[model samples]
Target: MRHYVAGGTEHGGGIGRLIGYILTAQPQSAHDQLVTDTRGARWSKLRSPPLLWAAMAVMVKDRLLAPDRVHHLHIAGRGSTARKVILGGLARGLGCTHVLHLHDFDYASDFLRRPPWQRRAIRALFRGADRVIVLGERDRSTASDLLGVPARSISVLHNAVPDPRQSGNATLDPPAPDAPARIVFLGQLGPRKGVPELLNALSHPAMASLNWTAVVAGDGPVDHYRAEAAQLGLSDRVTLPGWLDRAQTRALSESSDILALPSHAEGMAMAVLEGLAHGLAVVTTRVGAHEEILHDEETCRFVPVGDVEALARALADLVAHPETRAQLAMAGRDQYRNALSIEAYIGKLDAMHRSVSRGALRGASAQRGTV
Candidate 1:
């Protein structure tokens, strides 16, 4: 069996990373992909959205017509939703079964709050999908009630990351007793990711009193946050390195003691999963699918979203107590190995595509050696 996954190819974004994992985990001969969005460097004509969409439309037309190929579309809100609507419609019209994987972070404030025409596109997209994949149960209800998709057709599958432990650099040593705890934040520098709140939390008295250093990584208004960090007197200890490549991120994770996301909303953030996979004690909000898998003070630390004090306390506690931090980090890594690793995710994804024969299952398992 073959599956064609379509989505963005941005390195930092969730959908993009998911596609990367799928392409990387499964053999290319068994599974294929199409890049609907790209961080284009050249090819000026293809950079134009219309021309890119037209080119992809031709590709989709031919691919959907192929025999026994599963079409899985990963869609976010706004422009992503619009593009997939057309693509999914064409596939369905061609008598092909397609899966719609919803990764939109905003529905109430953004997608559902859109105008009538936008609502029409959203409705058309989900209702036509043969199977609908959501990152959590919250979205399962949303698709049923708002988009008129059947609840039975939807599946709640939290996102997963490639196991960092198996990356051959599994160094999760706790911070030295005399050295400051290392805190790393990975996400876009925007309000929804709680970057402003994270900076504020770091500047709080509780955090100020603790012995810690931080690196707020990811792309988005780096100068603005750097300036704010300076104003808060956190510039000395807090470093905003803009965006780190995968190698650099893995290195940061290896050297860091804690991973903090503190997003206001999420459909199961990749950073949190990555934190678990990398064996880092995490301090993040109990929003989205986070509350489902993570237990407060057990698997990882949990703080209330937008509450600077709570966030500060969480960070401070982890910073001060190395034993507690190490325990949580170990627990989180165990959780990753048991369920959230790419191997487990691929098994689930393969099942969603269809119940495969023994030979097909063997083929899927064979690619894990390559990863």
Candidate 2:
């Protein structure tokens, strides 16, 4: 089947990479890049005009429904209203199947909340889609309530991790003398990620009691987070290595004793999955989709968001008891192999594609492609 993995270049992370991998693995499937400007003036505004997007939509459809070819169409993670409708319109025009996979909670709703036209555009996209894919169960429930899509139309698929064949060793090993029980925070360095709260938690006496040094990975609003750390007097203990590439990030995860993510909002943290795969104890907040992969005191530990005291205490507990840390790490290893494996993800996606294709075919045969 020919899959068009459409997405913006801006929020390209594990999800984008996973999509690329799936398309690349299929010999017949050719991945197409629909590049669009994402640097909006406002934090939540359109980067380009609607006409340009409509033109791009024509281009996407032209490439997908090319003459003398058998192509099964699909678009991943609708970014903007124009882009979303453009793809859906193309699907309807070509009478092809389309999958509306969601990465964030609400893409079109953020700007299109009060506007009736925008809301209609979003609903049109939902109505045109054959299947809507979500990451976690909570996200699935929210999608149903917000989009008014039937429960059966939406599928809950957990983000999966590709196993690193080459474990860290001689060339790329964990931090030497992994003493002082170092911890790492991997992901975007933003306010919603709770970077400030983590710094505050590190300032407490309990965190200091553990002889811990932190290596913070990833980048976003660097100056702000650095200033916050300095203000809390955590500059000495915390190491801001900025953003590292995939290999470097994995090495840091392997070296650390614990991975902490005090995020205030998250779809599902890929860093948490990587830390678990690396056999490092994880300590994240309840805001994330951890309920799908983790159990309190089993595969990982949990704390309330922005609670410095609770975070400090959780870190102290992990640092103080080596046996507990080891047990959690072991459980994390098991969990990664069981639920978050790449094989499991492939199976889920394959099933979704088949189901959606069949549904679209049936819908198209009846009247039009309004699946």
Candidate 3:
């Protein structure tokens, strides 16, 4: 069967990387084709409405013309605009079964805040999908409640990372007592990532005596965060390494004692998954798939969103107790193996594809009075 995957291809965002993984994992028989929706250069702003429409139009036309196509379209993005365009317009008009994979944590809140007409439009787009793939239990509940879709129709698939244990670079040993604990944050350095708050947390009085260093690694306004770090007198302890490649990120993660990301929102952070894969003690806010995947003080430490004092205390506690960090790191790796491996992710996706394909065929046969 032929599968059409439509989403950002060139953008350096998580969704684009997700599409890359899906493409790489496809079996030979699937003959999957990727339809580029947005380019990386245009990622900072919304693509012109006419341009997006034209792109979707071309994708729909190509799918319609393909021979022996199963018409399994998987669209990944954050907002309802792309969903409305593809599922509501192209997929509906072409009678194609589609999967709506949501990657944003604030989708429910944003959906509720929209005008009535727009809200209805968004709901209609979600309801039209053959299957809705959400990142966690919370997102599934939100989709069911706000979009009026059944919970069974929504699959809670957490993002996965390759097992770092197999890489032979994972640091399983306890941290050296003489060395300061290293905490690494990997993602865009923006307000949404709570970089400012993280700086504030590091500057708190509780963390004054903590022997630790933090590396903020990712692109976006590095100068701004640098200024904040300097103002907090953290210039010596905090390192802004700009953007690191995959190998670099993996190396940093492997060497680090803690992976801290206090994001305001997320669907399922790949960085967090990568951190867990590398067996680093994770300290993050209770957002996105975190609530479903992480156990407080067990697999990782969870703090309230935007709480600087609590974050500082958590960091201090982890740094002062290396044994605790080691325990949490090992537990986080175990959790990754049990629940968030790449094999597990692909298996669930394949099952969903099979189910959707079967239902589509059944519907077609019934329409022809042959079933």
Using all chains and alpha carbons, the TM-scores for the candidates as numbered come to: 0.88, 0.81, 0.88
Report the CA-based lDDT of candidate 2 relative to the real structure. 0.68
Error of 1 at 160 (Å): 0.5
Candidate 1 runs further than 4 Å off: 1-7, 27-55, 58-65, 173-175, 355-371
Better candidate by lDDT, 1 or 3: 1
| C-alpha RMSD in Å of predicted model 1 compared with the true structure | 6.4
- How many residue pairs clash (N, CA or C atoms closer than 3 angstroms) in each of the candidate models, in the order given? 0, 0, 0
- lDDT for each residue of candidate 1 in 1-371, tens digit (9 for 90 to 100): 32222324543266778767766766553334444442232234355465446635654665556544566777777555666777777766764556888886766456756889978877887887778899887888788888899877888888988877665777755555799898999988999999998999899988877889999999889999999999999979999999887779889988998999989888889899989888899999887788888888889888887988898888888998888898999999888888788878877887887832333345445777632
Best by lDDT: 1
The number of residue pairs in model 2 that clash at the backbone is 0
Specify the poorest-scoring 10-residue window by lDDT in model 2: 67-76
lDDT of 3 at 315: 90
TM-score of 1: 0.88
lDDT of every predicted structure (CA atoms): 0.77, 0.68, 0.76
- Per-candidate alpha-carbon RMSD to the true structure: 6.4, 4.6, 3.0
Instruction: Give the lowest summed-lDDT range of ten residues in model 3.
Output: 1-10
lDDT of 2 by residue, 1-371 (tens): 43333333234455555555454444363443233332222243454455346544544555566521223233323444455576567766666566777666334336345477866767677766777777788767666776677888888887776665333251234444446887899988877788877888888888765667898777777777777788888898898878787668766776678899988877788888878877889999875467777999899998987888999899888887877888998899799998897767877787777777676567556786454
